[model samples]
Target chain A: MEFTNALSIATPELIVVIGAMVLLLVGAYGGDKARPAISLLSGLVLIGAAVASATGPLGQAFMGAFVNDSLAVFAKVAIYLASAVAILLGHGWMIRNNQARFEYPILILLAAAGMSMMASAGDLISLYVGIELQSLALYVLAAFNRDDAKGSEAGLKYFVLGALSSGLLLYGASLIYGFAGSMAFDDIAAAAAGAHGTSLIFGLVFLLCGLAFKISAAPFHMWTPDVYEGAPTPAVAFFAAAPKLAALVLIARTLGEGFHVIEDQWRQVILALAVLSFCVGAFGGLMQKNIQRLLAYSSIANMGYALLAIAAGTTVGVKAMLVFMVLYMVDVTGFFACLLALSRGGRPITQISDLAGLKQDRPGTAIVLTMLSLSVLGMPPFAGFWAKVYVFGAAIQGGLWIFAALGLAASVVAAFYYLRLIKLMWFDPSPGLTDPAPRDAQWVAYAAAAFSFPLVLFALGWLDGFAGTAARALGLG
Target chain B: MIAAIAFYVLAAVSVFAALRVVLASNPVHSVLWLITAFFSAAGLFVLMGAEFLAMLLVVVYVGAVAVLFLFVVMMLDVDFVKLREGFTRYMPFGAVVACILLVEMILISAAVAARGAGAHAPGVQHATDVTNVEAIGRVLYTDYVYIFQAAGLVLLVAMIGAIVLTLRHRPHVKRQDIHTQVTRDRKKALAMTRPETGAGVRPEDLV
Candidate 1:
């Protein structure tokens, strides 16, 4: 392909990259006062990128280093929009905390660019580059509040662990290249079909292990709770949403496009990670007192269901994974947005008890929070219910009803904590009214809550069709 | 014969230094050992005919990065003795992990030995006529240009992150207003004092 044609194929990522550099200059010259303007400009840039992605031609680019397809387009729209929400949430938060700087939004824009790369990555080299690009920005965002000891600690911990995971991924990629004589997914797939060797399986396991860390699947989930609790709430919202979706989609592409022929081998690894995630997310969440930590466990369990669907290694499974994540992504983004909005005594509420008597004073927020919690816990009539149904159905259709049953049982165990939050908000004694909700988070929470039940009813048909088409783009069934 | 012997000697010393980097109790000593390990590894790369890599391993790793590592280690207020105090307490757990990793490595090596790195030799092809830098340059720009640029963005993010974390503006502290100084008219800053040269400047004039 001509270089210009390849460049056209990656228009969305290019928009973000060039936009970030331009915004960096604006911020540098305009100083802190330029933050809000730069943020809005970046949002428009993202919208433009999304439009480009949705309308652009689909094909391999850069000699198959990148590919733009239905999967990439679908995932990019969700990620870019979520990245915008994250910037909005963080803007309100930094202003409230008196640490407003222009870099926050630019960092997020850069990270979104990285996520676009991940979604479109067609080769191991692109995969590693994308993951590192996303992770580097996040490490800085995690410690955005540098004065806070906990924030700095979170950043340092995430950076160290992220580097270690990158090492594992690189080693695995090298091994695969050594064995397969290729880096492109199509070539790797061809190589994998010809060989049923232990060395390849070993390399495959390591690669998936590295990816599992990205999605915060357990035993690799050790970083999520600390990072979520320590990082600024808005940054955590971004972490819990776009990056996870990008990683999950990347994993699906790798499995469906690259390692489809080695189903029995990679499936075991995926299934094992899913089961571990189920156990850890379920049992571990029961003991959490802090709200952020509880949400961390919730995300882990949600990823388990997604991974369970993915382990099926079918087109239906991939579709289910994509749908489940987009729904879960909105649920998590709104969930954290609510956390950003609610403050008791002018201090952001950290403890569960701080939410006591929340309904009495802040009835609207309380109800929205309740709706989100119920929706996320898979209560009937909510978006999460349908998400779970599709994933479980996919797993069963793939003849993995046993694992589906395990996921259901884990969901049962997980419901107790979600119920506990609801009970505290509605029934517990009054502490005090939370401060008035910030405009950004307030609007975000309302929009997210509306989607939690009724909007999903309206949008589910489109989402299901889009996700199906996206999954089919992987050339799997 | 000499090259083979030299490879063995470099490899042994490099491995020994790497072990010492981890096992040494003193943080400063460990850093120095890490630099030694880097040196020997660079020599090994040189022996393998990858002169470009050998240069990078020296200039990038040894010359720059290792010096920064040394600075951080020496500057940190770490209580190395206290840090190492938990060695005995966690030794059993650590040893179990170490053993598991060792076994896993052995298994992978065994698999590689039995199967001969599978379907092919390696992915990177070095032409006999082309120099190492030339081959790498061609691939870096054409085949993997997107990834190379993405890596540059990663470094750019690191730079932004350092500034964001460290840079703070203080309202009270005086700063250089070089632009203002440069645009100023000299008449305001300097007053003609022809009388002061003969009679000495009055205190009021000086003020």
Candidate 2:
């Protein structure tokens, strides 16, 4: 009976892993022609696993290593959906560049599997495993375009920084184990509640630093821009969306579950990181010429917003984070879809200068890019605006007025860069470069834009219910 | 008592070899030192009764990776003479750091020894039936399961990071197109050809 229960709980992760393995084998044998089918099949499998997770019992499983709950289900759904869209956006580029290999979809599926595992991780060990699984897949994906020098450089930079962070995390885990005598989240929590020692505190700080790097929060975000800029655009799109969502959920779970007793110790650390992330993300993006790098900084800022919600440690804050992340994912996907469609001869047109006069050559894509960029800048009637409003409101309700104010200031600073992109797209003259949108690329752009539209229209209705459900799931009244 | 002495000796050798891994002048020497370190570490692990990890470290790290490292180092055209020239400049600082580290280790060991043997905590018994490996495995698979899993993830990330850093694409070079190669006609690539005769060409040339 216990074995069956464990299997049931582990089923979602198992399904994705098995699917990924199958894809890997197919890639090994099927050659280039098998890429599209494999990609679609993997995407469908991810969606299926996410849906399956939703129907499972809502509690810890596998001897308290994995959790199956509404929160995990929700995060899994978001990650899977984003990954599916990213695969779709990548397809055209892959085919055009003769890179439509089986490895591409398989790697994406593996990464998604990792994120799914992370979402369900109920203990420290499981969390680290999930995080590493996802990160490892992503590292490969980041430099998948092995022929591109920049891609290789990006991969190298990400690896070096990532290894250092992992070491820090391991040391932190060891310290925590030494202090608490257990690696289980509940055990750690119990120990922390009884005795809040210096070693435990230091361990928690290091742990947070490791997670902060994953989320690309400030002081630990130096790798974000370089990695994003150097990675293939589709990989960047995946990086900016799914992993951030998963990492944020993990952070929330860690703080809310393990360190609930020592909130005073961690709250200030989170707040400082949140502020730095916001400032850097907002202001740093202003000078970026590469669209991908700009989005990377933007992702850092957005993650900061999510962190703000997590830092609140209120039920409402958790709910707000879920809503904010969902909306952020949609907006970012739309933005990347536009960028992906603007590529020429399989090479991404990432520079801000390349986007000049885009309106004249590809009016539809330009319009979508404009809306997405505006939404990113938090314009009214867009999904991003409502997401920010709810998050900032939650901050205020939690009496974190200073954080709210800083967020608002950062948002204003961030607006200049988003608007600058819009201005170049609409007002600048076309550079007479051939339009890069093949037939399939156009479809991806349309799908992304169409998805963003509904998100905006349904934001109010979606937020109320999603927030309530998330709040309840988080045990916040 | 014999086991303890052997364990201490192996540990000391492992530490010494590891130090030499960093201090050795030539890259080849460094790799050799690393292999030695692995062997000593494995021996220490065996003394601690972790046969699996010991065997794995020997077979995988020492036998394969270290050997590969040695081979690569041997192949590279490293200017060992230049590398030696800088040794004098940094030796004093390096020695001081090493001394500090040794002192710290001595203090830690002395503290632990002072704590004495069989100083078991209350309600905690040293198991008599299971070996150290089994004891550790039991704890790892049960109580510390999450951490064990987390460690796996860290390794996975490291593996990916290593692969990504080393994988580079060069476009200018002429490379075989797998697609074209797979579909090529055998006759086109391996045909029996006749020699061409030119003006004033010899009969041997024509043949």
Among these predictions, the greatest lDDT belongs to: 1
Q: Any runs in candidate 2 off by more than 4 Å, and if so which?
A: A344-347, A433-436, A439-444, A447-454, A457-460, A471-477, B1-60, B75-126, B132-207
Q: Worst 10-residue stretch by lDDT in candidate 2 chain B?
A: B116-125
Candidate 2 vs. true structure, TM-score: 0.83
lDDT of 1 at A359: 84
Give the per-residue lDDT digits (tens) of candidate 2, residues A1-477: 775766677677777777877776786588667877898898888888877776766667667888777788888878888888788878877777665556677678778878877887777778778878888888888878877899888877887798788787887787676667777787878777763443367678878899899889999999999999988888888999999999988888877778778887788899899999999999899899888889999999998899888788888888889888888888888787777777655466878888998878788998888877877788887778888888898889888999999999999999999999889988988777655576655776666566556646755586578556755665643
lDDT of 2 by residue, B1-207 (tens): 999899889889888998888888888889988988999999987876677788889999988999999889888999989999989998999999879967965674455446541132122345879876687788777655545654664464455445444544576555889998888787655645465565454544433
Model 1 CA deviation exceeding 4 Å by range: B117-119, B171-174, B179-207
Candidate 1 lDDT tens digits, A230-257: 9999999999999999999999999888
In order, the Cα lDDT scores of the candidates are 0.90, 0.79
Deviation from native of the Cα of residue A386 in model 1, angstroms: 0.5
- The CA lDDT at A3 in model 2 is 56
**What TM-score would chain B of candidate 2 score versus the native chain B?**
0.64
